[model samples]
Target: MADPRPATPTDLPLIIVAIATCLALVVFTAPLTTLDAMTDALGLSPGAQAWIMSGMPLGAACGLLTAGALGDTLGRRRTFVAGLWLTAASSVAAALSVNGLMLIVMRVVQGLGSAGIMACGLGLLGQVYDGQARRRAAAVWAAALGAGVAVGPLIASGLLAVSGWTATHWAVAAVSAALAVMAMSRLPESDRTGDRVDIGGSVLLIAGLACLMSALIEVRVGSTGLVTALLIGAVVLLGLFWRIERRTGNPILALELFRYPDFSGATLAAFASGAGVLALMSMVPTALVRGMGQSPMSAAVILLAWSGVTVVAALASGRLPERLTPRQRVIGAIAGCGVGQALMLAAGTGTSWAVVLPGLLIAGVSNGILNASLGHEAVQTVPPERAAMGSAANNTARYLGSALGIALISVLIAQKSGAGTDFFDAWHAAVIASTAFSVLGVLAMLVVSRPRGVVR
Candidate 1:
């Protein structure tokens, strides 16, 4: 079929997508500041708390690749609008959750919805914008991501002060509903021809990731038998997924894309960002509140130093000298984040929240650059029609890394806590581990950097 809309302007679509992307991140990070209250109200155990935190990322990891393929094959507008409705409905369900398990399930569903929004939203932008315009749009999308992280805690804190954690969900639900309606009416439709969704590959990939995440969560609870079984299952299922993708005509993830060094570099950067900075930052609120006896609102405000600066830095990234390639920017940004993580070390029980402010601000700037560069690289690395697939692949690595990182951090914290270490000390260990992941990421990127040409 020919294009349904005649020369649609990019501005309106960019606005709608930026809002949806912002809202998705808002939902993802809101729980960070509100975890203590949510835990107390739900009567959650430590294991359950970890699950609630990591569940959404796991779901996104599972759904993003499939969602992207579907969006490209079916219709971007259809997929985007459907994702908004799903998110709105899931927020209401989360608000009504009665227990830890119920809320965890709801969170996973919300993540699936978010996967659709993120994959299709970026795809829509790539469809409408080209060259320098695409770069600017990517930067704007990156800024929206930072803005959401900066604002989510404040929104949650304000609502929690007035009502409770559920109120935040209710507010999210309202905004999501409004966005869905707007998207359905205003967004232009775009879809590629001659591509079919890979049902077998999607099933295998999702199941494998689910098994891996389950094992990670179960390992913390000392369920060695279950963890072992899940790990074995994950290996087998993921191995099968790889085989199927290699053989299938319509693979959900095209293995050929990984041949490009820039693509591989971008994926590595995303994973490192998730596992290192994003994971460490997610735990900061808990540490501030539990370890340092800071109030929830106080923790949120302190985090704003990091997340707020991220927005400014992301918006400003487009202004950086043209000499810096996206890969170079990503490498430098991640390395900067590692340094920031090191600067944040040695926070003992008596340390003030202000001790980490400088580090947070530095890392926030680095994170902004990373986000914008990754957003640009995700689409630029792939064939034009496969922009959604590229976005999905990049995000799959990100959320999967995040799930693993959160689990690892939880395990490290729990081990230290079990050994009678204080919260701050345990957090110090987690920070070190996270920083190590960043270092590894930088090394990997450096290795990929040996190649000289851009993929596109």
Candidate 2:
């Protein structure tokens, strides 16, 4: 498959990359600012906070699958740009949110839009660029996602530093609006032939996951007994989802796509390693607020350091696949993330903020590299026809792990600490649990690894 698309005077992808794709990442991390504030404002308990926080990702996962289907049906450029518009509109609506419920509702809308951009963005890039240019673009895009998460806190803090928290939302809104407009005019839709839209399975898949997350988030908050029954029902729905998807002609998620050993391992590794990485994202911010006694803005900055290092790593990761063999890099990243998880677990328990700083930076760096490597491997192995689905699958795996990681780590850290419990002890327990999980992730990677250090 030699560059099936037209060879342009300059890369069409370079323009698309410059305009729209990167901003989706920037907006994806935008909600971090609101996570703590909304919890306090809405008077949510811990578990409820986790759900509200994870809601965007849940919506995002569904959105990716559905959006990918639409991109395949309508066109990548159009679908991706439409997503940006939806996200921008949601961000503005979120800024006006009166309660956590409103915010969550807004986030659902935001996720729908974000999913569109995320799913189609990569698909279009796949359609636009080829060979080495495509590889470089994919690596950089993955890195950019890491960078956006890293930079978002810092950017939000700066806005809040001068204007205030509410003002920061407006700033995010402004950025989204700018991107939506540019995406509309500047980018080219995918002209790929033989694409089929998978609609029937997408609805069931999204509804099942949404129900499950809703159950989890609610449990964390109100903990109604019937909510318990609802969760059980959601589990049953998931079982049906698998069965129906198998029978459905066009499933949102193709079960066949999981057959490749390298892709399978990489996706699982991506999920687990992400769980380990986000263990810190969820906990550290809590440590800053609950443990170290920092204000929302100040605490965010402390955590932003991790986000900052990730940015640098993501920006630098394009040369990674070329510099080291893919298998070696993937294994190394898994190990590095494990090390970072151990450090995160330890630092959270320790008193000295300075001691925790190094671990935060390490986690950031590991996160950046891990994301790029997995994303690169996932896209490289799939056929051109399956590329959008591949991208959607990767995004779902990573975000779903993040959602679970938040809940699991939150439970671990809080399990030891009560209202009267020692903060350091709770922090230590969470970090240790996170570290243990990360180490397990490395072992999982080892199972799929080849001796020559190639992922295949």
Candidate 3:
């Protein structure tokens, strides 16, 4: 097939970047609305379903560990195209899975594909676009991510209204296939730096993350002894990974990057947003369906206020004055998240949509602005040579925070909402935890920066 015309130096390749960003998040969250259907169809226990839910993020974490270095060496365009194809194939496999275990395994592969796509897409944005154009593209990219995440469940809910859950998976596969074709034709290859990745570092980081994630996922379902063992193993592996990075020549992550005040602040803010607002949002669909007794579609409709505002805020963030730096914006957004969660809790346990709409709108706008600037700041704070690495570091922290939040939230819900307790009671517990995280995020933002040259 003929390659499409290469984008000129002035062009940002916004279409491809936006589509990839949107679709990756969409596919990741599409399963949220269909959890009930999946468990029922496959006769899955809670443990199996948890794996299916957490599998993608786990794989994505591993992908983040490797994809940035790969993009530096293999060329961003190639990695991006490869990721799209992998995602498409994985989606198809997920759609065809006959058992819960099979589906969970496919989800893991899909997550890895998604990680490559996001890492390369962001890296390419830094490469091909410059000055205000680059900032604008970052804003749009962030907005697209929020829109996709918001719309994914809505799309699945709508599909489930008329068709089975498998239909949603098929739709994702078709979209991914089209995107792969477009990327292959339109995206230009990045200049290959020929930087060989550290194989040992990659393995250690992945192993550490896997153990940590496994411990979190199995907490509620597995035996107490098993959970304790996994937790200890996770800590040991992660500690070793940290020590190895300090000694390795080409560490997957540059331990010294934390020396930059802006980079440190941005990374902390990203983690906070992921663990607090983003994590809490993940629970909304389930809460709507089970706690409020709304149809999946109806629940999605109610959430439009939250998700829609986020897109608008993200798109507009780049245009904001320089006086309000990304740090200020992120801090404000974290505070908003805390207030929003508080509002939700104060509204009481009723099914009334009116109770939470104000908080959702407030939080949504803040999240939009925060998401738009978080990683852009991180990437821009670093030297140009390490732009991809900077972006990857911020994202790795964000996703790790997300995985932790999800696991903790799930465990709390399972423990609180049982035969004797109300579902809303459990939701209340989750919201409180989320609020605490947001508060911590705000405080961290305040202290995260230490003036570039100040000693830690």
Which numbered prediction scores highest in TM-score against the true structure? 1
Runs of candidate 1 with Cα error greater than 4 angstroms are: 1-10, 40-42, 418-422, 450-456
Q: How close is every model to the real structure, measured as TM-score?
A: 0.93, 0.87, 0.92
lDDT of 3 by residue, 61-148 (tens): 8787577767766787888888888889998999899999999999999988988888888878887778777777788888988889
- How many clashes in candidate 3? 0
Could you tell me how far off, in angstroms, the CA of residue 374 lies in candidate 2 after the best superposition?
A: 1.5
TM-score of candidate 1 relative to the true fold = 0.93
Q: How would you encode candidate 2's per-residue C-alpha lDDT over 103-129 as one tens digit per residue?
A: 777777877888887777777777767
RMSD of 1: 4.2
Native-referenced Cα lDDT, model 2: 0.68
Candidate 3 Cα misplacement greater than 4 A, ranges: 1-12, 161-163, 418-425, 450-456
Give the Cα-based TM-score of candidate 3 against the true structure.
0.92
- The worst-scoring run of ten residues by lDDT in candidate 1 lies at 1-10
Tell me how many clashing residue pairs each candidate has: 0, 5, 0
Rank the models by lDDT, top first: 1, 3, 2
Report how far residue 205 has shifted in candidate 3, in Å: 1.2
